[model samples]
Target: MEAVPLEHILLLGAVLFSLGILAVISKRHAVVVLMGIELIFNAANLNLVAFSRYDPSLLQGQMFSLFVIVVAAAEAAVALAIVLRVYQYFKTANLNEIVSPENK
Candidate 1:
């Protein structure tokens, strides 16, 4: 059995994080932004798991990653609820329109 290098894992994580940042920046819809956030979370998880694998003596990275996943799940739930309400009230999921003063 062979192990993957930490640099490779970190590079993958960096790519995922960059894509997530791009999506969050360029997308106007709330749902797309949420998906971007999930990407970012997954990237973080990947890094944590990679680090934990290298340091088997302590599983703190994995434990923190688990907590991060839990928090991301809860954040998604609450954010989606807010997006839903905003859609119902404003009739659009575009973040720009939702926050626009003209919408009110």
Candidate 2:
């Protein structure tokens, strides 16, 4: 069986990254933005694993991706907690509408 080409993996990662960027830019909700951030992180992880596949002796890419996964999990938890608080106070998750009291 022929192994997948690195260029294809890189292209896929690039597409994922671009989609994540678009979602972050176009979405208004905080949770959606967070999801976009996760997508970006996943894209990076995919590229890392793909590059590391060529050199199995060095597991740096896999290790780094694991670290990123842990960090991303922590980030998602904290971000959701903050979003929950914002929602409780503002009664809405729309970032554009969640202005400060001073601004209102």
Give the candidate number with the greatest TM-score.
2
Model 2, which residues run further than 4 Å from truth?
Answer: none
Query: Per-residue lDDT for 46-76 in model 2, tens only?
Result: 9999999999999999999999999999999
Best-fitting candidate, measured by lDDT? Answer: 2
TM-score of each model, in listed order: 0.91, 0.97
Write candidate 1's Cα lDDT for 24-79 as tens digits.
Answer: 99999999999999999999999999989978899999999999999999999999
Clash count, candidate 1: 0
Report the Cα lDDT for residue 23, model 2: 91
Clashing pairs in 2: none
Model 2 TM-score is 0.97
- The C-alpha stretches of model 1 lying farther than 4 A from their native spots are 99-104
